[model samples]
Target chain A: MSASYSTHSQEKTQSSVFRTSVCKEALVMDDELVLRQAFASDPRKGCELLFRRYYTNLCNHAIRFVYSKEVAEDIVAELFANFWYSRVFDDISTSYRAYLYRAVRNRAYNYLAWQFKRTDSMDAIEDMPVDPTLKPDEVLQYSELHQKIEHAIQQLPAQCQRAFLLKRIEGKKYTEIAEEMQIGTKAVEALVSRALTRLRAELKNDWFLGLSGLVILSIL
Target chain B: MTPLPKDILFDFFDGKATPLQRKLIEDWLMIPANEELYYQYLDEWETRHMQFFPPLDEALTQYRQELNGERTRRVRALYDPPESPFRFQRWFWWSIAASIILLATGGGLIYQDQWRYSTYRTGFSETATHRLPDGSTVTLNANSVLQVPRFGFGEGRRLVRLTGEAVFKVAHLPDHQRFVVDMGRGVQIEVLGTEFVAYARNRGQHVFLHKGSIKLDLPQGKQLYMKPGNLFTVDADGHGKLTETAPAQSYLAWQDHWFYFDNTSLSEVVQQIDEVFGVQVVISESGLARRRIAGNFKATKADQLLQSLSELLNVKITRTNDHIELRTLTL
Candidate 1:
């Protein structure tokens, strides 16, 4: 374990570590160092650092499932509250960021299940397993793209947003959604269509780092 | 390579394509280049609709307020030593003696009658019972405390706040009056009429229903129902588990000045000792914390429990002025 840890530390250049910290230029260090400092002294600062970094991203991820801002905020806030009060923050096994994201996602699903009154069995949200082969920079870029995509969706017309969320998140069929929303089937289709067109136009010109033409072409 | 039409691909992505057009797009996506284009559009499709944007600043402020409230409540709970004047020592005799003297001097009576709400406390190696106005009864374990409101006894909700371990025998009321035990940390156990043991004091609470049933309202708006012989454990970390087990009557053995450890870890035993006897027991070796011991023993005194544990684990128990240290017996 010590050998692997040493190699891991060696892999992170001092410059990158310094670049990561915007405040505290002289004593800028890695997450592990920050964690150790937290374990030793006043842990609130370290906890706040982690909370600030991932709070927005986690809220965005959670809103995808629960679809309510207040509920999502309550979920994340309660998670951090428990994390602090229960001392799990001191004993995180995996990378702290991954742990926080997974926690938020699981709770969001649970909240959605409770809200939908499905107490017996929770329907699984089919999400693609994160591609482990992607580099750290690629992961960051993908996360940024994900947030940007969510923001763009939020900017769409209200009807388009509702249609897209019900179909995509709730996994509702267009016919079923049309019936529920009291609209015709073609309106649902056009709403989804308009939503897609707007999204495509919004992302078409935005330059994403390391997103080659071939990659975009292959995926489209 | 032939370029696939964008309109057909979009329909296929949304699962709205006709059978014939679906086949066409499927075939086109079979090509790696077309597949890549499919994912790009798929990403865009998934990204385009956002339902809500939480105000991060407001959420942060709320979180900070919750944290500060918790800290303040904890401090208030610990320091509000009502009848016990010399509570700083927290040692077995000095604190209990202080309480006894206060009780004799009518300090305990004054404290109880002063506030509309009543608080019940037990010193180390002591257990006390308080009967509520609704005919329900609560028995607190050693070093535990419970507060019952004087104003709203049997009116609507029979609510009691607990800071340590307690066993409750709730009276069944007509009209289905709610009997709720607020266990703090956003956890509440509501029972109409039941016999259950609630253990708080640690970061979380463990509730075992010996008879009847109870409903637990968790922090994240999830409700859990527990039946007889069910053990529900929830921690401050937002983790919860429900297990069906044998009647946990042994869990309340502490009420009788005894402890029953069934394959429990030494660390937990140490914590129980600290709670029940007001003595901090520190094991020098970290590995010894995991040593499991099962036994039924008396817990009237701190040294007696430590002595039994020393013989059981073959460790040397040393008691200082404030803390007890357990060390491996040196050969």
Candidate 2:
């Protein structure tokens, strides 16, 4: 681990427990050294700094899962609040970015569970693991893949992107999604179909799902 | 497996399908092509992230800028025992602004400076000075935040978003670019080649032009021009009314520790005090919300203003742990 890496692991909080970090400066600050010292002394300060660093990115990431800004912002805030109060953050022993990204994933799943409470479509998504091997290479690869998908989706018109994101990523029931988005269920179906057709036209046979894609998405 | 009706497919996906419908969709799931497309959709979706971030943030940011001109000058005017609140305000907004500016101006061609700006905020009873990208000057008061986006007229719109209140002496740019200040209450003030003082919050937008011409655009799509010596108040409803002002110099009298209120409501007066002096002033009764206050007091401290108010209105002022109360004083 680099000298600058800090995270919310449960091991460090045996003393302080989970308290929100007070440090909320930017991540790309020129005075990184000053901030690191500050974070080491005050983990809540570290959380604040981390929040400042990732607020926008996490919001953007949540939009990948939910359609409502209110819901997305709430989900992001909930993740931060949990991260702050959770003993794990008090013990940050790794890169703050990785710890937070994983935390967001957990929070997102929880949010998804609440979002899909009445529906049976998203029953397959189990609890997320710590994934001890969320290596830099994998993170980099996924980041790049995310950028590529963003670019591809950006190429499509706005409505198609909305439908595709809602149906696929959110795993939302059509009626619920239609109600949230203020569109008819038939329109939602047509949109999903249209988005799939457009995506298929674009991908051709490029193998969007590498084995896990097929199995997981099939069940999802 | 054969094609199922859209309703049957919907019910199956929603898990509300009857046993037959469930069995049929499950059987259809056995097909490789059909299943492949489903995951492919997820994979592609997980990519673009149309799921998390939405367009509303950008829209709101735009609207926030258009309402209150992007800087709030808060005045948390207390000079007693120093506390953490003062230090927190001084550090948080300044540090955040400095950090974001670094990220924004860093050597990235992908940066849309328009989407980026510095947000400056001050806390109660505190004041600080800041410089803008355009060499303009600003003095932030307590509990105020001003956002200066990444892109000015250099690339596109020269707009700044405001949350609380601030005093601005906008530097003139020769390119004839209009520097616009956006407030939160559905008002925007466009000015150029002159200096002005502005105050705005979530629901109120007020402007006192120092020397140049400013075009005020209300959230309700009404625009008014405030010439020199003009003061305008744009309410929450985006209705703006112009009033004659003594002079631009009078607006700066508060810097000398004095404020003059001419028939302003008790609520409005209390809000100004809370923002400027950083004290929570509460009206004991709801009727005080509508009580019209007209008075002038010393320009030195908050206690002086309180004394003047108590004497004139015969209003008893009580201090509690959380806030000060103003009530009808017993004669």
Candidate 3:
């Protein structure tokens, strides 16, 4: 594995070097260096630069999960507001880009859990042993949870799947979906509810296991 | 463990990482500084495949407002402590009592107008006839609201606000008071003992006089007088037109659940249905929307109208809840 990894790394370094020289525009200075220096000298200017750079990217990332443009923008705005109010930049050890993406992902997950009324899952998330020193484990858990939820969505009935996607992925109102499908709003609501019930049933065991793991970790 | 290459991180982001590669990346991510490199690569990948670009100016403006609001709140918290440890208990109780009284009076003053007016509403597929205090009668169409003042309705002025369609029969007073119907958007009807049908909606403003004379106060300081049987229409763009030979009585046919269409386009017919029944009509083809039909149809419900329309036009109409779809018949 180590031998393969080294060969892969060597090949990638040569290709990246070639690609950067050919396709990429010449950047005068590294963004991180400028941002860090600005932050050390003047915090407000640093915040402005950070927001101008990452606000759109963060919103785009958030909308992939939340599906509503307004909600995505709200989440990014709130994250920035909290970042400023809590003085997180002063103590953050990771690059701002890394911290912002992870924070936005966590926040988007929390929002989805709350929106779906998954109280048990939400409790499991809150109780997840958030040892910042072992952040890789939490990242793995998030990826697994996201994959499970997506898989369960794909397994829904055709009609139920359409209704769920319209409501969640397209950010459409029930009345709008009813109008499009030529069905009543009540039918749309029923379809969405049926989808949620199936999703909850599929996720129940995973959440239980996660909660138990948290319990054991707490004991240890 | 050795650091993973950028290409492997990119592969992981694209969901193309094998278990062995994933294991190596996981081990590499265990280092604190490598996590930053992971995010930097992720950011680069995201930039290459960005799905949306949010409105920057609007978001920045909102963020500035949030920052200012937070600063003000923090300043307030620092300067104004709700209760000081050195303050007397009696003064605290007195201040609380004083604030309650002040809040009550202040709230009452702000909401006093809500108590002065009474609003009447009709739900979807429903119509209602209301008799006002001055012996005037109003028949409201479906999905409409009318607001009339509770007090002083007939004393100094008889004024009412209308949102949707309604037929008004103003009662003549011996003192010669004018009746005014405010249709919003600076359009109003002034009458003295008259019968008229007024249609006010987001689409247009239309007034058809049936009995006696009435004056229309339109937008842009324009006034027009209407004789009986005259139909005055102001479109969504505030362009006004008058038809002297209009069949004014046909406008009141809705009171009898009858619709009179004289070579009316399907689109206009659908708009009328939307106003009167709150049902949305979706025409599958633009050519179908321009088809004209001339007839008197009796339909108390939206489905009945849709059925009759489908038969008359030789088209297919399907209804579900509050939505109706019209399509050309396919053989």
**Candidate ordering by TM-score (highest first):** 3, 1, 2
DockQ of each: 0.07, 0.03, 0.13
Worst 10-residue lDDT window, candidate 2 chain B: B77-86
Decide which is better by DockQ, 2 or 3.
3
A9-55 per-residue lDDT for model 3 (tens digits): 33433343222332232231244546766566666777878898999
Docking tier of model 1: it is: incorrect
Choose the strongest candidate by lDDT: 3
Instruction: Give the distance in Å from residue B253's predicted Cα in candidate 3 to where it truly belongs.
Output: 41
TM-score for candidate 2: 0.39
* B122-224: candidate 2 lDDT, tens digit per residue: 7665666787656677776557777664211122225676766677878876555567787766678887767777877656678888787898887668788
Per-candidate clashes, comma-separated: 17, 57, 0
Candidate 2 lDDT over residue span A71-144, tens digit each: 45545655655554454554554344545565554454344333222222223334343454443323322333
Ranking by lDDT: 3, 1, 2
Worst 10 residues of 2 chain A by lDDT: A211-220
lDDT of each: 0.62, 0.54, 0.69
Candidate 3 residues lying further than 4 Å off, grouped into runs, are: A1-30, A64-67, A113-131, A207-220, B70-331
User: For model 1, what is the error of residue A69's alpha carbon versus the real structure, in angstroms, after optimal superposition?
Assistant: 45
